[model samples]
Target chain A: MAALLPITHLLWDTWRGNLTVNPLQDWTFRTGDWALRLLVASLACTPIATIFGFKQASSVRRALGLYGFGYAVVHFFIFIGVDYRFAFDLIWDDLATKRYILVGLVALLIFMPLAITSTRAWMKRLGRQWKQLHKLTYIAVPLAVVHYIWLVKADLRDPLLYATIVAVLLLLRLPWVRTQISKLKYRRVFQKL
Target chain B: MAPKKTIMKIYSSEITPEQTYYAQSQSRRQFFKTAGLVASGALLSACAPSTPSTVDPAPTAIKPEKPVTAGQTDELGDAITQYDAISNYNNFYEFTTDKQGVAQMSAGFVSSPWKVQVGGLVNNPKTFDIDDLRKIAPIERIYRMRCVEAWSMVIPWSGFTLSNLLKQVDPKSEAKYVRFETLLDSNRFPGQRDRSFPWPYTEGLRLDEAMHDLTLLATGIYGKPLLPQNGAPIRLVVPWKYGFKSIKSIVKIDLVAEQPTSLWMKSGPSEYGFYSNVNPEVSHPRWSQSSERRIGEMARRRTLLFNGYADQVASLYAGMDLRKNY
Candidate 1:
């Protein structure tokens, strides 16, 4: 429902003939927003699962991560297809001159490995290493935020909001949060005894 | 579905005798029209070769205006192709930033009722209607229009020189710049309410630039009344500068003593400058201006200096630092 809202808004604007600013810019911004939302949703899954004692909500984490990957791919392609117009020369020029585009390309490249290894079979094969490799999201999230902040000129409000959300989510996974989880587990074990 | 079928059946059967008679009569009328056309065709064939052919000569047979002078061949001058001339029209951004949208929405403008208010530092502030302005001397000049967006067009525009028009207004010695304001009717222009950019577009030129011979208060393009999107009634066309320098659909031409605030500059000072000349060396902050894709020209064609009218306008910017002016 949350993803549908922004898509509907974009449709309304397009129907109203108000898509004057390059469609690529609109596509990139919307995809980036959706990717951030998905990442936030993935982080919220564990909290919701613990609070409600419903393991089903945690099952959505994989889907949310994949959604983030989907949107990131869309954002990357929109930049290449519309902005660069598939001109290799122009793309090369932009990569050289625009540091933000370079950082964004790098962030997308780093996310590609995680996206490819996201399947259940690969997860099972990697076993314990799967959890460690997937922790790259911690790095990828902030890098993506920085990429967005660098791209925008004189408008830090939206990027700052995303950064704040990602920061809070990451902070929620600190040693204190682990100690609290351990205390809760100990209380549950003692209560069962 | 059954009810709809019944409704359609009744609608078709409702036709009375009088309606049927009228329908039959209409077909008969059409037959007579066809017969008349056939008879005219036959008559034309019969008279085709006889009586030395009294039919009127082709309208194009009329004597050409400005006949070629002695020893002057049509091939002597550098000819701009008709396709290039037609397609290279610099789109006015008032209706919409989309090049085609400007062309579409301009049709709604009623240019006949147009009036221009000339005020500010001018001694004789006056308003001139479309007819009043047309009565003045008209000169046709073919010049290139370069857009700040890195596209360019060459156009043959017809209008009186701005210097000649300015002489009537008699600007005070303090008048150092001329600012033009486009018509601001949101009802007619849907793009006015767009928040993406400012509306009631404004542009300005230095006093000397305004008074230059290359500057014109244009009313027509391609020898026709200016298209609505092309700044009908009147617009300022500075051939050597970017297209935005030529403000369109001008409602007011203010002879300001001070440097007038320009719309683009006020919105983003770094991106737009006051004197937006066509200099390849000085690139726009967001994009390069070294080359422009001339609309409808082959993509590989090189951009020209002063957009290929350098001989005419090169002297205008001579001794001036183009980078600073740009």
Candidate 2:
């Protein structure tokens, strides 16, 4: 429901002509924005589970990852179809000439294998190898962020916000950092009692 | 009596051409007068709808303007961009970064009580009232405006040649460049608060470029005085160069011997240049300049050198390397 809200709002906005002067650009930007937000959200699950002992965090992890990938697909489709008019010459030129677009494409490719093997059936079949394969998300997540950072002109606020969120989430993955956060919370509860 | 036909004829005779003329006279310009009401109909994200929900039925005290000398041209057959599209889709960053919001912000602005300071390296330094500057016999020119961001528009602007104005000021022999500054008013123009760019946006042109016949200090468009968001009172309009070269809400004019660096050049020198002439061969460091998406149109058209004014302005840069300067 959360993942679909942005597209739903955009559909209403686009239909009502309530978007920016360049609606096409705004539509593409908003969709990609949600995709990054959810991708980073999915990564935050592991840290939440370690620090807060939230058992349910793991349940939503796969769903969030899948939702992010879905939006990324839509974002790429908008760029090529509406923005570029599916012109092969322009697409070819963009891939070669624009570094950011190339980076975005590579990031998408990295996430594809992980998405394909996301189901429990494929995960159990691959066994321990699944754990190693899923580690690619760490690389893919940062690459997606880089793609967005490069895509923007001057305003770095949006991209920087995400970069900082992803940084904090990554830092929490450290055993010492997670133990520190856990101890802080435990101390707060003890003081209350 | 003559039944249905007679009644229809009688009603048509009563309303007729005089009613149409009366309506025209009662309004300043069809668009500017109703601009405050625009937001109620359509809204864009960056800009508030400048139009009020209810329009004033009566016209203000502003008098009818004299028609500018219409310079005959072989029409490019390009459709005049829709008035709303031209006005709504703007980069008047002084109001806000979002082009849509300026319309609302500018409707409250008083452009009539305006003055332009022209001094610097000139023999005659003068500050003309907005009304007096409008008096210097005008001309109509339809020019294509190509933005650095790969969007384009065709505008019919009303103004006399910039050379005519420059001549009146009489630039001194040492003056090789002409620099312009936008009005500095943080109270009205919120964009000044943005530390990302230097305040009171500045732009410059070579003295020769400023003196070109095609260069105009546009005062109006669409047979009406320019709307505030559209750079009311007076603004520079260099049709051949990128649109940023044609600065808006101009307050001061300075002539200098050295090439004056502009706002964009200061922000990202690699991306913007001192000479921002439209050249297809040289792309902006960030995006392709080969094609531009016309604001209301779908397909992007290939951009032309000097925005297709090469025959007139090409010789101005004949010997210089465009790529280096670009």
lDDT of 2 by residue, B1-326 (tens): 22332111111112212123333446646644453234333433324555433444234212122111122111455654556677787788778776777888777877768889999999999998888888887676677898887788877677778899889999999999999998998877877888888878899999999998788898986556888888887889997788888999888998889999899899889879998899877765455577677776766577789987777788899899999988
Model 1: residues with Cα > 4 Å off, grouped in runs: A1-193, B1-93, B195-198, B297-321
* lDDT (10s digit) by residue, model 1, range B193-310: 7765677889998888889767889887655677777788788888677788788888888899888778777777866788877776675543335555455343312345665556
The residue ranges of model 2 lying beyond 4 angstroms of the native Cα positions read A183-193, B1-74
Residue-level error in angstroms, candidate 1, position A8:
24
TM-scores of the models, in the given order?
0.58, 0.82
lDDT per residue (tens digit) for residues A1-193 in model 1: 3555666787788688555333444566787788777867887777668744679979888888778777888778766675455667655654765566677777778788898999989999999999999888888878888877876543367889988988877876788986887788889989999
Clash totals, every prediction? 0, 11
The 0-to-1 C-alpha lDDT of every candidate, in the order given, reads 0.67, 0.78
- The worst-scoring run of ten residues by lDDT in candidate 2 chain B lies at B6-15
Query: Each predicted complex: what DockQ?
Result: 0.11, 0.23
**Docking level for model 1:** incorrect
Q: Is the docking of candidate 2 incorrect, acceptable, medium or high quality?
A: acceptable
The candidate scoring highest on DockQ is 2
